[model samples]
Target: MPSLRSIRSRIRSVKNTRQITKAMEMVASAKMRKAQQRVLDTRPYAEKIYELMHRIASREKAWSSPFFETRPVQTIGVLLVSTDRGLCGAINANLFRSLVRFMKERPGVRFEFVTIGRKGRDFIRRSGFNLTGVIQGVKDRGTIEEILPATQLVIEEFSEKKNWQEAWIFYTQFESIMSQKPRHEKLLPIDPEVLTGSGNPPNGHSGEYLYEPDRRDILDVLIPRYFETVIFQRVLENFASEYSARMVAMKNATANAKEVIYGLTLTYNKLRQANITKEISEISSGAEAISQG
Candidate 1:
């Protein structure tokens, strides 16, 4: 058994750790609330844009946008979004695991990756994947400009640079404080059903939307904005998921530290009482002996 003094020191250490975890928990909670709100506020607009893009995509050759051009997917672009730091429970680990599964599912398919955080960049490097672009230090509330590099990489791959035929983005989606879902969302060569959250088209000829000037004109204007909206919403969703995971992780840590402190304090108290009782017993014995003498 450890000495009482040593146990006291351990109790103090655990208390300090608990304090730190408690503070971090509070910070993560605050950030999670803001991030969740941003996601909720922007998701509808992003979804509508997604639905509109898919609707236009149904026009096929009738629509003149290069983004609508379909080709054999010789190369695929992947935009992997993850947090720069850890302490977020299994959030990043689960994402990385899913990414591995995605890669495994497409054995021969060459991938060009654009990473939006330090963790993703590291994974790309370690996994020996081609790193097309990297976006680091993005805030919880990232602006369109800040996320342009990533979206641009996807556009460049399929259009400007013309290296890849299709693109997808992977990120954890915030469902609730306790549930963050990792999603693999196709970004380009638009999957109509996926875009609109519909499992399948109702018929061979899907319903259409009317345009003011023409389909070409509207798509030309909306295509770039669609890219921006998709990327922005992904980033917001990523932020919210990251913060929620972190808050929950920190809360669990604080709770665990508290349990450790309680156990240590209990041990310390028991040992101290034993030592005090031993000293009193020894002193009393000595007094009785002295009186007898």
Candidate 2:
């Protein structure tokens, strides 16, 4: 049993913590909404480009682009998108776990990493993996230009055949406010099946289209744009997931702090009542003794 003074101090501390957590929860909620809207706005464009790219690649098999060339598996390039900050529940941990699982699945394969956030960079560095590129301190509402460097790094490495046969991206896909799943997708080799596998296009039609110049010419431009759009969209999805996870984590923290405050208040009241009762008893005993004397 803590003293009344100590219990009062604890209650005050918990109340202060609750206030901070509540404030963080509100901030995260607002950011999450904006991030969600950004993802929603970009998803259609991403899907349409993907469908167009798939259509082109499937039709133009005779075209020879470096992006569609498949080479022997030797070294793999991985772009990991993570949150810059912490307190986002198990989101970062889940991504790391997914990375570990990936490594386990492909044993003895060398992985070159390009990290988009401080957390992923630190993880890659601490794990002693080959970190080829890093892009940190991206804003909450980051632009595509902010991620262009990493995207280019992956593109140049893969296209130039710099020991990178396959390129992949790991990110948290924002399914809903309560659910964010850690996912990875193969970025290079321009797999038309994988592109079309992600469901129908924005118009809900996957029919063939007429290219203006030629299929090869369109692919030469569309392939790179498709890569950039996919990477940018993954970053946006990661942003939404980060905010959603943070908002939920802060909400839980705020609730736990409130519970602590409530418990501490109850203890404080009990101790104060006990102290008052003891003091009254002592006063009555002293008065009785003085009267007898």
Candidate 3:
């Protein structure tokens, strides 16, 4: 059994750890709220742009646009969005696992990575993949400008005929406070079928729309803007997921620390009682000896 002093010291240490974890949990909670709100606020615009782009691409003339062109899949450009920091449970782990699974599914296809956070960048480096671009140190409430460089990198790579034939993005989609899932989405070659809801227009709107100036000119601007919006929305989702995961992880840590403190306090009390009992017994023995003497 450990000494009472050592047990007391351990209890104090655990209490301090619990305080830190509790503080982190609170901070994560506040950030999570803001991140979640941002995701919610921007989702409508993202969806509408996606719908509009799909409507345009549904036209036969829209196929002439480079953004609508599909080629044989040989090499793919992958954009991975991850949290900048750690202590967020298995969020990053799940993303990497999904990436590994995706790679396994496409055995012969080559991938060039573009990372949005330090964790993803480090993973690409460790995995010995070709990292084309990196955007790091983005804030919790990051703006589109912060991510524009990586977006442009992906766009430029896809635009070149000799480069990647496909571009995909991997991110954690925020479902709720307790649920976040890693999502793999096609970022380029805009799948009109997928986005247009399988031939059904969104909200039952007839796909008859007149473009201002000309259709080609409108798509030239709309397609890129739509792509950027999608990327930005995904980033916002990742931010929310990061905060949610961190909040839950810290909450669990705080609770576990409390359990440790409780168990240690119980042990300390038991040890101290035993010591007091022993001392009382020793004193009684001495008293009896003196009386007998």
Candidate 4:
């Protein structure tokens, strides 16, 4: 048991905490709606561009884009995408765990990382990973200027033959508000099947596709667009995932705060009741004394 004053203070403190959590919950909810819409809207464009690119590649037998060819794995590039801020649930932790596992799986594979956010960059730097490139301050929505540089950096690295065989991007794919799956995808060497929809055994093609121009010429332009579209899609998914995680985190915090308030209210009631009991006892004793006197 504690004094009334102490219990009052505890209740007041919890009240303030509850207010803050409630505000955060509202903000996260609002942001989640916007992010979810953005992810849904951008997906179709990215998919269409990829499909067109595949159709072109599938039509050409001798397309010689560096992006289409595979090479020996001398060096690996890891592009890690994470939120710039914290207060999200286990989003970053899950991404980090997957990253660590990826590293462990390729012990002898020399790797360089391209980090997208401050969180991932800081983590890579602190862990002393060979971080080759970092792009920070990417907006929540997809922006061409913001992503173009990073895409170009990787494309140039491949075109220049920096001894990098493959590039992988790690991101949280937005499945639903309650579910986000950490995904590791090969970004380069654009899977011909992903483009042509042939790689998927279940695609069951209707017929051979038609081409607007020479398939090789179309591929020359489409490969870079493919990279851009993939990056844009990733940015959208990351935003949706961040908002979903934040919303869930704030909701939990709000619930915990409410529980704390309930406990404090119980304690406050008990302390006030004890005070009333003591005061009643004192008054009754005084009345008895007066009567006796």
Taking all chains together, each candidate's TM-score versus the true structure is 0.92, 0.92, 0.93, 0.88
Model 2, span 198-292: residue lDDT tens: 66433454456677898678777877788888899999999999999999999999999988888877777888888899999999999999999
Q: Write the per-residue lDDT of candidate 1 for residues 32-83, one digit (tens) a residue.
A: 9999999999999998888777866765546555577777877999999998
Q: Which of the numbered candidates is closest to the native, going by highest TM-score?
A: 3
- Flag regions of model 3 displaced more than 4 Å: 196-209
Q: Which regions in candidate 4 have their CA more than 4 angstroms from the true location?
A: 51-63, 193-199, 202-212, 286-293
Candidate 3 lDDT over 1-293, as tens digits, reads 99999999999999999999899999999999999999999999997887767666665543465677888999999999998999998999999999999999998999999999899999999989999888877777778888888778888899855488889999999999999999988878777777555556555655457768887787778877887889999999999999999999999999999999999999999999999999999999999999999
User: In order, what lDDT does every prediction score?
Assistant: 0.85, 0.86, 0.88, 0.81
Per-prediction CA RMSD (Å): 2.2, 2.6, 2.0, 2.8
A best-first ranking of the candidates according to their TM-score comes to 3, 1, 2, 4
Q: What residue pairs are clashing in model 3?
A: none
Q: Kindly give the number of clashing pairs for every candidate.
A: 0, 0, 0, 2
Model 1 residue runs over 4 Å out of place are 61-65, 193-197, 200-210, 291-293
- Residue 151 of model 3 has an lDDT of 77
User: What's the true lDDT of residue 251 in model 1?
Assistant: 95
lDDT value for candidate 4?
0.81
